[model samples]
Target: MRKRFLVLILLSLPLGSFSQDINFELDFSAVYWAPKSNDTIRISVGNNGRYIFTDSEEVAKSFGSITRRFQPAGGKENADLKLLFDLKTIFMLMEVKIGQNTVLANVDLNQFMKKGKSIDSATVRKMSATPTALKIENNGKKYKLYGVAPDNKPDDLIYMAFNEKYPVDYDTYFSKLMTSATGELFSIDIPSGLLVHVEDSKGEIILELLSIKKKKQKGSANIQLKLE
Candidate 1:
């Protein structure tokens, strides 16, 4: 049997002062080969300030639902949804049903790679060992976020080192980080029956035993996001 994959890309505009809320719409398609047949999948991602929704259609069945939220390593909230075939792979179809409208799309995994050639192995290792840190100034307060050894303390010098590696205006970098984090929260879903330990930059686990519950006939799950 051939494996299937789906990828959804959601983009949000830069935040600015406004009464109206910001939302996102995304759609994509993909074709795959199974042992007995070729199949196609469609996916969509939507956010209307308050909540994020993802819808997928595979063959003909539809899956639509709200996402699960997680507290990241910086005391920030994150959300995600996943359809898995096993321990290592995710399913490729999703769908959303609004009051009177439905949105859909498919994912082409190969298309994601088309954006650029592969990175070198050494570069990949370096990135994994040291994810770029971001210093954000929101509402006149500055905060730093990054990955580090599980035992190290978070401080200003850490922020400065990250700043030197990625040279950009702090505000601009902060905005991008917020947008990216929001997108990840919308798409990735935490699995049930597993323990997800969320932490702060100081390596302190703040949230544990997050639960996922599926809404009745809704094709989605609601999460009881709790912090310790």
Candidate 2:
């Protein structure tokens, strides 16, 4: 009787316990094919919106270990506000810095998709196969999500699996990723409570979950993304 009672109590707990509000770290990678050669770039992201990308695994490892601080330049209130991801406001233009150059990421899907080699309808269909339910065993301290099995449709699988796990109303999520501003779009609504990983359905892109830590309060400093 006691064992059954305990089982019933466990089943009654709110799902929130399984998903607490916390920051996360993620790793991403993708292979790009050129006429003569192909290269893979690696990216790492922290839930606080800091990220670094490099072509070498060693560089990615070093960057992933460093602690980054972001602050405003001038003494301005809400100076560090991320408007596009602030949820309360409508979507706005945003720019991201890569090395010494900065570029605009406010473009729509059609423009973003142009970056990758085009795939046919048959390939798209193969990738869009129904995603399997993810079995997430969340302990009070850590969480884990299993990877999708390798198959013909990497892109469609990624899209379907990612959306199924973390449903965002905005289709712009993919567009944001095209600019390599991964881990930025989830600042809004995410049904999974927290997003640890995401990948492109076609296998061209990948994001890996690394860590989830408490978000520390920020001090007053004027910081903002300088948009062009």
Candidate 3:
């Protein structure tokens, strides 16, 4: 999945008047039971609003909970969850803009394992690195999300969507987030775990809600949103 959705309501009160940073975490567990083997994929949110999407295949037989903590990459302010979690960009880009098309907040994720070639001279390697960034001039009316490959390599078009501008409201969003009619894109908006399930010849994948934790800051917010 190259692209992805938006806000899961960090605040109950409308965000039009208030501007501050808040941290939230959405936990989910995925599993597939094939008679021969079991597979699992897990996804979660970060305190700074990064979504961690990881995929694992063929486990021995344990479904114990796991939280994979990763330190920020060297010289990189925000750790690439795409790299740390399952080594693929399995999450999509999401955002919430407030007054005057100003981006209030955003979340991002994508599909893993879409590799780009690397030239080391000594050896060639297959590496997948797509940095997600989305921009909208008219505040969610229309969006263009692009996946920029690291090291000035090739880039991929994640998602370009259109919607008539609607005034901000809880009902206006949060029921369902859709990127494209086809399920090529993936998005993780909390509680939306309700609508997330996958089944194919390889068994089934489920997102089970575990917990949600949130904290708000009163002063200036240093929210490092991924999308523009």
The TM-score of candidate 2 is 0.26
C-alpha lDDT score of every prediction, in listed order: 0.26, 0.28, 0.26
TM-score of each: 0.25, 0.26, 0.21
Clash count list over all predictions: 18, 9, 7
Q: Compose the digit string of candidate 2's lDDT tens values, residues 1-228.
A: 111000111112211111112222333322222222233333332222332222343332333311121112332221111112222121222332323333222222222333333432222111112334443222233333334322432432342223123223332242244222321212222232234444454433344333333433321112233347
lDDT of 3 by residue, 171-219 (tens): 1131112221112222322211211222222233222222222323221
lDDT of 1 at 203: 45
Q: Which prediction has the highest lDDT against the true structure?
A: 2
Which regions of candidate 3 deviate over 4 angstroms? 1-22, 27-39, 44-176, 179-228
lDDT (Cα, 0-100) at 13 in candidate 3: 20
What TM-score does candidate 3 reach? 0.21
- The order by descending TM-score is 2, 1, 3
Best by TM-score: 2
Candidates 1 and 2: which is better by lDDT?
2
Q: Which residue window of length 10 is worst by lDDT in model 3?
A: 63-72
